[model samples]
Target: MALKATVLKARLNISDMDRGYYQEHAFSLAQHPSETPNRIMVRLLAFMLNASETLTFSKGLSDEGEPELAERDLTGDITLWVAFGQPDEKWLRKASAQAKAVRLYTYGGRTVPLWLAQNKAALARLPELEIWEFSEEDLDALTGWFERSMTFQCSITEGVLYLNNDDESLTITPIRIKDRS
Candidate 1:
């Protein structure tokens, strides 16, 4: 028998001073068997960073065509597509064409910089795409606060993120690799 995805529930209170956006979101995420806790936390972090009434998690790892998270308008037009980790130039090209905005969160300690350097020219062509890179240590620390049923109080100020529960807390400042306007 194939392994089933684990459903986890989370309630997040987000305060993003940088964007002046504040909202509460309830999420039900299906954790794939092969997905690590760190990656799962990254998904949650991505959601918190872009919390919106229309934002939602997609089929995630199970769907190749869909982004990990997306925000859509009432007419079902995709406004934003959020992807995790490194994606190839082809995928980035497709996403930029389909959505109004596309954002990628790249993680991995030393490998992330090298990957960016190698793909810089190709990535720069997509003016509507944005890329942010997080360190492995920050992700590891964020994963420590993960739980099946959890509540998080998240704050973002001056481009720095702070997430915490009752027992643990994490602070991360993501590096912006590409910002095309």
Candidate 2:
């Protein structure tokens, strides 16, 4: 009998700034590049909206009832609020440990402790995730993946894993390893 397979396709579109500005630039849970807050937020949102379990992004308005810094250029720092799928407070602490130019904070709405994020105890989690810095080599590898699209598949027995892409699509399939020769 053929192995039962679950196919999933994911699409990724990187920001134009990233394509024009940095080295095969791709953001990850572990780090971000030094750039403007708005651009950074765009980058984060591009990834989070698709990958994060829960998240939000917004800006405060000025006392004049205008959007905060409406008169000013959109080049200033802006705070970002993110909440991964965990019920703890440590993730915020960890993300804030380093002195990044932009502010990254947890939502008062709900918090996910870092231990749960770190310990892999959460039922919904990101594991076996990798952030690939776009490079000629990486592009070559992805080209290979595309050329062999018909044979590709991915599965998760326990956690929520996302395979990010700079410019590509994918099909994920869940199957028993033993069924493969």
Candidate 3:
């Protein structure tokens, strides 16, 4: 029998000063058997960063054709596509063509720099792409706050992010590697 995805519930109170947005969102995330806690947390973080009523988590890790998170219009057009980790140029090209905007959140210590160097030129050519990298230390720190049922207050100001639970807090500043308008 196949292992089922674990369902985790969370409540996020977000205050994004940079975008002048404030809202509280409840999420039910399904963690795949093969996924690590760190990756799961990163996906949550990505969702927080681009939180919108229309944004929804896709069949991540299980579906290669869909993004980790996507924002769609009422007409079912993909407005925004959000991906995590290192994706190849072909995937970037395909996502850019399909969505109105695409954002990639990459994390991993030394490997990220090398990956960026290799794909920078091709990624730069995509007019609808934006790339952000989270530092390994920060990513690891965020993982510590995960729980099956949890609550968090996420604040973003001037591109700096802070995720706070009652017991602990983690700050992350995602580096913008590429922005094509």
Best by lDDT: 3
Error of 1 at 145 (Å): 1.2
Candidate scoring better on TM-score of 2 and 3: 3
Task: Tell me the lDDT of model 1 at 8.
Answer: 91
Per-residue lDDT of 59-169 in model 3, one digit per residue for the tens?
A: 546786887799999999899999888888899899999999999998888999899889877887899999888888998888888788879999999898888999887
lDDT of candidates 1 onward, in order:
0.87, 0.26, 0.88
Worst 10 residues of 3 by lDDT: 59-68
In model 1, the runs with Cα more than 4 Å from the true position are none
Question: Number of clashing residue pairs in every model?
Answer: 0, 9, 0
Q: CA lDDT of 76 in candidate 2?
A: 41
Please identify model 3 stretches exceeding 4 Å from their true place: none
Preferred candidate (lDDT higher): 1 or 2: 1
The digit string of per-residue lDDT tens for model 2 on 73-162 reads: 245422222222222334333333321211221111122233324644332222212111222332233344432122212222232212
Reference-based lDDT, residue 86, model 2: 26
TM-score of each: 0.94, 0.19, 0.94
Error of 3 at 139 (Å): 1.0
